[model samples]
Target: MFSDFIELIGAFVLVLAILQISSDRLFFSVKVYALQSFFVALSIFVIGLYSSSNDLYISAFLTLLIKVIIIPFTLFEAIKEMKIKREIETYINITNSLMIISSIIIISFILTRYIDLGGEIISKKIFPISLSIIFVGAFIMVSRKKPITQLIGFLTLENGIMLAATSVTYGMPLIVEIGIFFDVIVGATMATIIIHHINETVDDIDERTVENFEE
Candidate 1:
């Protein structure tokens, strides 16, 4: 019953996450994004319990610490620094986004069916959701214009990738996990710098248009 609950929670979180990505409000989306990571952390911990893997449990703790806590705080700070409004302008309509997301979910399930996952019980069941989450994350990054939103999207995708890897492999080696986290830290730092440049490049559409015309 406990494992089943965890499994359901994981799937539910993924759904909320994708919806949050499609939202037109920036702060609300970020809040939902953090909520998604929290549920992911919980799911990881629950997976550790079911698998009886110490490494998974540790990884879950770190996932909670880094993803749920530290990363969100960092992102919030970035958002404040940018002083951007909470209003988001989406190029695509919400209904179309929902349809596309549904299609991605179907595609994920179909693709997951072809591969034989590790000999784990839960991994196979969760695999489709994991893949969907990744695709959704990537979709969020490219679909939005704001760089901050793009960073959030990328991190959300990272959460899915980590969930997929750890859930499938019972967690990677300690060294590998550390290296991956380090790389993520570096990536976030670099992304912030790029966002600063993007903000400076064109604060308004007319400036952007002039720059484009000049090119």
Candidate 2:
């Protein structure tokens, strides 16, 4: 039962990532990120329940508090304030994006097949998914033209790393987890401010325009 839940949560998070990259709507992507973060937190909580790890419990709580709730709320509010609705363009079309994402997943599975991390057997199962999430998140950062969409991609990448750490090692040191959370919160807040500034300075927050800037 425990292993089954682990696989299920990991798979669902991967599906959400696929969904996010396939969509052009910025708000929709942000909502998808929030859902993905929720699953990451849930996975930690489930693992903690089975392992009786207090650190995992606290880590799960922080994930819920920061990733699922606060960050999303802040981004959503920032978007509302900016009155931005959707991504102006994606460098890769949806059809090609799906193809690339599929290829990334297959390659991840192939790459991690024989490697062993010496943690839970389930960690081996999740390793490829975590790796794929990291790659796909990076792809998201590059393939989307909007800064906000890239920010969402960055956050997704972080969630993938967190998922791997929580599942593989069972949990990191409590203080380390807390420090990571602090860094993420600070980074997210700063990124949001930058995005807002971009929106204010330009008619559209498109990356293409950024390259054309005189400076």
Candidate 3:
């Protein structure tokens, strides 16, 4: 019962993340993205407890560090420093963004229908949702204009990847998980600094505008 509930909650977070991606305003999207991360962390943490595995604890901590802490802080600093206080000027129109998001959800359900679990209870359940979440994260990154939004999408994708690993295997070796988590933390901090520099040097938040740098 608890596992089912956790899976449901994970699915909900997936929806919320995509909803944030669809939002026209950057601040609201970032806030929603943060909330989504919190939910994802909570769901996974509970699942880890139910399984009584130490690696899931590490994964839980990774979610806390990556999704709850690093991603949100970077996003906040990036937007503040960039002075991007306006609503997001989307790459595609709002209506089209909604359409694409809806399509992603639908396709995810279909794709999840055929996961080859080899008759394992654990495999049968979480893999599909994790894969769908990853796909949605990628879709958001590709659709959004703001560099911060793209980073949110990327972090969310990593969340999905971690979710898949945890759900399918129940846990991995703690040392390996911690090492990978450390890499992500260091990588995100570097990304934040690089993004800040890019914004200052080029005077824009849209990465596509890099092409317009004055000679």
> Candidate 3 clashing pairs?
none
Model 2 scores a TM of: 0.93
lDDT, each prediction: 0.74, 0.86, 0.71
Better of 2 and 3 by TM-score: 2
Q: What are the per-residue Cα lDDT tens digits for candidate 3 across 1-215?
A: 87678678767777786676667776777777777777766766886888777667767877777768777777777777677655565567777877877787778778878766675456455776777778878877777665666776787787787777666776567787787778877777787787777776775444423234434
lDDT of 1 at 69: 77
How badly does each model clash, as a count of residue pairs?
A: 0, 0, 0
Q: Write the per-residue lDDT of candidate 2 for residues 28-83, one digit (tens) a residue.
A: 88899999999999999999999998999999999999998999999989878877
Model 2 lDDT on a 0 to 1 scale: 0.86
**What ranking emerges by TM-score with the best candidate at the front?**
2, 1, 3
Best model number under lDDT: 2
